[model samples]
Target: MSKTILYARVSTTDQTIDHQKDQAEAAGFVIDEVVADHGVSGISTELKEREEGKRLYDKLRHGDTLVVRWVDRLGRNYQDVTDTIRHFMRQGVVIKTVINGLTFDGSTKDPMQEAVRDALIAFMAASAQAQAEATKEAQRAGIEAARRDGSKYRGKKPSYDREALGVVVDMLGQDKGASEISKATGLTRQTVLRIRSDPAAADVTLSRWES
Candidate 1:
């Protein structure tokens, strides 16, 4: 008997997979095998790079139906998502989503229906990618404006501050270790270590960033 498989991913580990499973079940998918990718950010990650995501690639065969919560769970950008979906469709894999009840299959005998499906996939994938880029740009602009004005931006103290951590970072540049910097600044060893590791990247954070 052919099986119906479900794949679910949450951007953060804090979000439980149960919710996604619930939605899939509510949508009437039996979910024979569930491949879950957790604590992985979809923005910077490709579907195939994820552990469970990779499993989906290996397990799925021609004529197998793959169900996901959404298309975004399948990829990072518009082109990647569309390409991945189309590749699977060509291989006789059916892509199904719970949220919108969207289904893509390769059994279409009508040229018009295939064209419509392709267009819809292309448009939706582009929209998803554009939305992700816009969100990142907005966050960056907000952080930069906050930094220039010295206004509190993300609710609590920033995780990284050039003004305060600069000295420690500079000391590290002079060959200071995390322990030495931690002792000098009265900061935790982990914080000092992180600063030492990514000083330049850390230096751009706002002072009011929340954990």
Candidate 2:
């Protein structure tokens, strides 16, 4: 029988394996198994390079389902994400996301449906890469500003980290309410609202804290 497998890349201390599993369960996914890579950088490491991530190719079979918190967990960049998803779909594996509850499969023979699915995959992969790039840029900028201003001007540390900020941003993009995003991410409602009002500022704040 085909099983549902949850794949997670835990990049930060706050983003724990249990937290991801809980999020998936909360999202209503009945996971049969879980494969995760701790301290894995989704932006720097390809899924195939991860110790547990590599298991996905061997563990998954035809008709099995692959679940992730987001498409970003599959690859490092736009091309990698797109290629990975297409490869899995071609292998008759259905891919699903916990956040948006998106499903992609190769069962559809309709050309229009295929086209739409492919387009959406491309868009999501691109958006993931864009968000990664933006976060990196914000960190660089924040570090430079901190260096220029010195310790005396360093602002108060942010309550949330980069991972939390990303979650908030994703929810905000989906037009989710601050209270909802806060509850989902375990962040304060005020923090969610601050991120919604100005994501760049939120990013900078987190970056400054890191600096």
Candidate 3:
């Protein structure tokens, strides 16, 4: 049997995979597996290059169904997003989005329908990418203004506390999976990787951050 898989991504700690899952469940999806990549700049990182994304690609099969909250969840840019979708469609996968109940069927035979689908994909993907870039630019402007003021500027608060992050670090050091750590601590997989990249630094910064 084919599975219904959810893929979610967040650029900051303020975002939570649990919420996305809840939203999907509320919308009546019996999600079989969730693949998430956290703290990655969607505008910059292509989906295929992400660690969790790579895992997702490997896990998906011909008959599987892929679900996302939005087209942006698949990718930030138009070309990357469309190409990724095309690849999945070629493999006989069905892609669905939760927000508007959007479904992209690569199996459409009618020329008109195919053109419409392609055009829709292009529009949505472009919009997603534009939004990401705009948000990034706004954040950059805010940070620059803060720098000019010389104020203590922490962009967003950390999602995990010292204790929770400590557990994540411990689990990571034990070579636990990102999904495992994310589920245990409610931290995003990207945050897990960031911590794993430098546990000692994370510990020190988190310690100071708490104080």
Candidate 4:
């Protein structure tokens, strides 16, 4: 029997495995199992390195469906993400995303469809890596500014933390409404709006608090 499994990486307290599962279910995926890695940095750890992530390789069968909140959940970088997707597809596993309802099937025999699927995978993987890099850069810059300025850099603390900010940024990128992001992240709509209005400032706020 082919089953659908949802994989999630919960790196912080703000993000929950249940929330991910719920998101997948809401997106109409009849998930048979859920695999998640807690306290794992998606940017630092490759998917195969994660404890539960490794389980995915063993648990998923040829016809099983692999579901994720986004393509970024599969790996840490562009190369890693693309490689992982291709590897799974080669094994006859179908990959799907809850966010965009995107599907990648290796069973497709059409040459044009294969080309389009490969292109889309490449684009999404690159985008995931780009977003990760941008977040890292913003944090580095914020930390440097905080260190140089000391107490002066510490303004009123942001209601949301680094992880929350990242979630907000991601939802914003997905074109989610401020109210929806606020409800999802447990942040106020005003905070979501503020982050939406000035993400760099939000990043600096989070970094200042971290320092």
Best-fitting candidate, scored by TM-score: 4
Candidate 3 lDDT over 180-208, as tens digits, reads 99989888899888888887877766655
TM-score of each: 0.71, 0.71, 0.71, 0.72
TM-score, cand. 4 vs. native: 0.72
RMSD of each: 5.9, 15.3, 8.9, 14.1
Over the full model, what C-alpha lDDT does candidate 1 score relative to the true structure? 0.79
TM-score of 2: 0.71
lDDT of 3: 0.87
Per-residue lDDT of model 4, residues 37-135, tens digit only: 998887778888889999998998899999999998886598889988998999999999999899999999999999999999999999998998998
Candidate 1 residue-wise lDDT at 184 = 77
> Which stretches in model 2 have alpha-carbon errors above 4 Å?
152-211
Cα lDDT of all candidates, in order?
0.79, 0.87, 0.87, 0.90
Top-scoring candidate (lDDT) = 4
- Order by lDDT, highest first: 4, 2, 3, 1
Single out the weakest 10-residue window by summed lDDT for candidate 2.
149-158
Q: Which has the better lDDT: candidate 1, or candidate 2?
A: 2
For all candidates, what are the clash counts?
Answer: 2, 0, 0, 0
Off by more than 4 A, model 1 = 151-211
lDDT of 2 at 116: 95
lDDT accuracy of residue 186 in candidate 1: 79
Write down the TM-score for model 3.
Answer: 0.71
